[model samples]
Target: MAPSSNTRPILLIVDGDPEVLRALAFMAETRGYGVIGCATAAGALADLDGSVSCLVLDQNLPDVPGVRLLKQIRDAGIRTPALLMATSPSAALQIQAAAAAAPIVEKPLLDESLFQQIENLLAGA
Candidate 1:
């Protein structure tokens, strides 16, 4: 059965890697969040619907920088909470993401930190 709209956290995940996308989707679904996986910035932008409660983005997409995408969405007045992930993110990138009000989750998502952080962000939102 489909989860009730108000009960599930709708997550929009944007990553270039198909493997990562699949893993995230499975994780999100297993955790009972409605998952929307997109392989590109354009695809993600197109799918940003009202139901989405969070934006999970890869820092370096082939088509556009994850920060850039977040900025664009914010500029468009979309206030969806965003979690940006990168592998060893540069200092400048970290500052930029914070300036944009998006939290940066360093890549290799080894522990439960990612999920914990997501929970905090969404709960606060």
Candidate 2:
């Protein structure tokens, strides 16, 4: 289905779980965001661009950690805001995410917080 919003901010979500990826993409699309879901960090890196309004990356990826991927994205000069999805993140991971300015969204996204975070990020973008 087409996005509901005219602007339709693009969101790139990289997750290792197919189910999680599909669910997140559908949720974002329903909220009027254009969603590009990928199963690997490499695909996410390749798809990274200025057009993307935000990113939702899973912490446990096949090729690399979500935080590491964010670093690569920044190193490549893309300042797009990102949300790192993790379950009970470690102190080091949390520190790294803070360093990269990517907030950690807990997994099993059970409430509207994820959408709120996305909107907040987009608003500041």
Per-model TM-score on C-alpha atoms: 0.93, 0.93
How well does candidate 1 score on lDDT at residue 92? 92
lDDT of 2 by residue, 24-103 (tens): 99988787888888999999988887788899999999999999999999898888988899999999999999998888
Candidate 1 error regions (>4 Å) = 1-6
CA lDDT, every model vs. true structure: 0.88, 0.88
Q: Candidate 1, after superposition: displacement of residue 48 in Å? A: 0.4
The residue-level lDDT of candidate 2 at 75 comes to 90
Candidate 2 CA-lDDT value: 0.88
Lowest-sum lDDT 10-residue window in model 2: 1-10
Instruction: Mark the regions of model 2 whose C-alpha exceeds 4 Å error after superposition.
Output: 1-4
Judge candidate 1 against the unseen true structure and give its global Cα lDDT, from 0 to 1. 0.88
